[model samples]
Target: MVIDMQKYFLNPVSHAYVESGPAITQKIKALQDCCLGRNIPVVQTRHINTKEGAKRMDRWWGDLITADNPLSQISNDLKCDKATIITKEQYDAFLDTGLEQLLKKQGISQLIITGVLTHLCCESTARSAFMRGFEVFFAVDGTASYNEQFHLAALLNLSHGFAVPVLTSEIIEQLESRT
Candidate 1:
């Protein structure tokens, strides 16, 4: 599952989605396709702001993207029929969200995560997922951030702590072998 990758980045002040995000997006598509082929479930998490929840928001300057903000919509290519579009107000996707229930419902024990701002949402979700007992595969090439340091730092930390950091191609190979 890819974590909260909404439009806070589009605003000049909050910063647009990580610059090289297309690389991650491309990898996501590949994973999505593979998952679809194998009858595996895929979930896409979005961080949305409700009227009450939009208060503490501030990634760049003072800009905030609420749930109603059209910019917060998932990218066009990422809108998938089989993918569950889960929304959350907290940094952790599981907080007050049906993510855990959905995972249980889908019987998903293994997750391939790819998304933006590796240090923040990505790493947080990875840790939480790991703690929740999910086998996590952190897609290095399928995740990006604003700066190189932030991206690498999060990857290293997650790899050492909870996730198994692997390239997109490696994930595909693993999936193929399972089939």
Candidate 2:
């Protein structure tokens, strides 16, 4: 599951929000394109918060996902519907979403992760999945943050503590080496 790669990430001032919009794009089309080629299910968890959540996440609240947030919409090329887009208020994807059940139904043993805010939502979701005994493969290059330190921190932590971290190229190689 990809976590919180919304238009808000383009902003430079929002707390924990990174600059991943048009100027300094993060996601490599190669990885998403690979999934598209294989028909791999790529579920995106977007953060569309209520007014309460917005007030609660104040200062920390990223303006993009709110009702009035201008950047809430996902990128045009990578559009996701309500069904494919799991909306959640919590940091963990499993808190209120049916992500676990979806994986189980599809026999998905592992999750290939990519998106924005590498150290926050990505880290939180990775931890949740790891605790639930799901194998997680974090895509290093496909994910990004405000800076390289935050991005590498998430990768190092997930790779050493929570899950195995793999580069986008590595995933493509593995995917290709198999069928």
**Candidate No. with top lDDT:** 1
Q: Candidate 1 clashing pairs?
A: 9-15, 9-16
User: 1-179, model 1: which lDDT tens digit per residue?
Assistant: 87755555523444455676766777888888898899888889887766566556665336655767777887776778888888877667777787888897878887888887688878888888899999989999888888899999999899897999999899889899997
Q: Model 2: residues >4 Å from true position, as ranges?
A: 11-17, 20-28, 53-55, 62-64, 80-83
- Per-residue lDDT over 1-179 for candidate 2, one digit per residue giving the tens place of the 0 to 100 score: 66776666655554535664343233545666667678777788778777665555655644436746766756554674422788887677787688899888988788887777678778888888888888988877677777888888888888887888877788888878777
TM-score attained by model 2? 0.83
Model 2 pairs whose backbones collide: none
Candidate 1 segments whose C-alpha is farther than 4 A from its true place: 7-14, 59-61
Query: For candidate 2, what is the lDDT?
Result: 0.72
TM-score of each model, paired residue for residue: 0.89, 0.83
The TM-score measured for candidate 1 stands at: 0.89
